[model samples]
Target: MAKAFASAGDLTEKKISFTEVGEGLYAFTAEGDPNSGVIIGDDSVMIVEAQATPRLANKVIECVRSVTDKPISHVVLTHYHAVRVLGASAFGANQIIMSDAARSMVMERGQEDWDSEFQRFPRLFEGHESIPGLTYPTTTFSDSMTVFLGSRRVDIKQIGRAHTAGDSVVWVPDQQTMFTGDIVEYHSACYCGDGHYEEWGATLDAVKSYDPQSIAPGRGDALVGREMVDAAIANTRDFVDSTYNAVKPVAARGGSLKDAWDAVREACDPKFADYAIYEHCLPFNVARAYDEARGIAHPRIWTAQLDLDMWEALQG
Candidate 1:
């Protein structure tokens, strides 16, 4: 029998947890669900990665309230994914910031991406009606931007492309804490359907340069120690590299996309099968890896129809 499309069968709700990884730095994680980071600056608060909807985002907001009553002054969207940015309205932040590349993606393919992801994972879209429509960045930066919440400093860089062309990370220099979106998952699947494989690894190198002591990943628990943070970076990088290695040889030998995907799945499954979103991300990750292995540079924009067609062709 063929597998279901993406996460269509995943309907159970996940438990949420908030961890204070450092002074005023918090990680809001929902078991294998989408994760968020809360940064309480001296005077205000900044939330990294809005949840999938206003209702869902409120959950994060509530978690933020638990520790600090500071206003959510800035909402940082590390990338332009529907599940990450659509809930920006809830925060009423003074500024919604994103990389220029991400802003461009929002204008170019935001709606289509929204439709595709909404259909792929219904559980994540539980409060779809709460979204006010496509969310746009109030402020856009080209490479890097620095913001201050009183005495605290948060540095955001449009580091090399990883999860998307506009992927970025939030760095807290004083506390040595980094909030990496989907770019560096901890024991969780890295969704690469829109990723740049080679550049993703290079971007991980940039992240490693920070030598962060505490790291908050896009989908997993907060890493409070240096060892855990390093392991998460290595784990994410290895997953991307292994996929490329397995798929590249097959593509070079003129094998079909399905052949390349099967090869990678065979090789990567043992190590990553139990990870969060592993099952749902596999087909899409393989599809993108197959294209990159065969020399494609920009990842093709995924649409609702593309999701079904590709799933049927590759999975069915």
Candidate 2:
């Protein structure tokens, strides 16, 4: 039988865990769902990724309130995916930040992404109606910028393109902890629908160079040691390599998208079958990889209808 479209069938709520990866640093993880990072400075706080909606963002707020009452002063969005940015309004942060490239994506395809993802993962958007509109960053930097929460320093930098063109990693130099947005996932699948497969490994290498003692990844558990942090980075690299390498040959041979899908499934399933969102991400990953293999450097925007069409073509 065909699989349920995207994550539509994944309605069961996951257990939420608020893990402290470092001193005053927390990772808000809900099983393998999208995770958010909390960095507590000497005075206020900085949030890594906003949840999908205001209701969901409130959950993160609750976790933040439990630990410290420092006002959430800044929100740094790692990329422009709707699930990551739409909840910006709830933070009431004075500064909502993103990379310049990420802001361009928000202007280019934010609404399409919102519509597409809402139809794809209903559970994430529990309070979709509450999202004010497309989220735009109040401040954008080209490469790197540092923000100070009182005496604490948080560095936000656009290391390289991996998950999205404007991927940013939040670095707390004092703790040697990094909040790597979708660029590095633990056991969860990397949604390559808007990814740069060729550039992703290099970006991972840059992330590795930091030698973070702790890493709050995009999904899965909060990594608290060099051993676990290295493991997650290696696993994420393998997942990207496996998916792209599988599709490249198919596209090189002038095969169909279905052929690429089958190739990717054969290459990835044995290793990543148990990964969270693996099924939901497979078709889109294969589709993008196929396009990239055929010399498409930039990924095409995904609309709600394109999602259904591609799913039907691949899994129907």
Which candidate should be chosen as best, given lDDT against the real structure? 2
What's every prediction's RMSD, in angstroms?
0.9, 0.6
**lDDT for each residue of candidate 2 in 195-287, tens digit (9 for 90 to 100):** 999999999999999999999999999999999999999999999999999999889889999999989999999999999999999989999
State each model's CA lDDT, in order. Answer: 0.91, 0.95
Enumerate clash totals for all models, in the order shown: 0, 0
True-structure RMSD for candidate 2:
0.6
Give lDDT for model 2: 0.95
For TM-score, the strongest prediction is 2
TM-score of 2: 0.99
**How big is the positional error of residue 190 in model 2, measured in Å on the Cα after superposition?**
0.6
Query: What is the C-alpha lDDT profile of model 1 across 1-316, one tens digit per residue?
Result: 9887888898888889999999999999988777899999888999999988998999999999888888999999999999898888999999999999999999999999999999998988987887989999999999999998999999999879999999999999999999999999988899999999989888999999998999889988889999999889999998999888899899889999889878988899989989888878888888898898888988999999998988888778
Runs of candidate 2 exceeding 4 Å displacement: none
TM-score of each: 0.98, 0.99
Scanning candidate 2 in windows of ten residues, the lowest lDDT window is 125-134
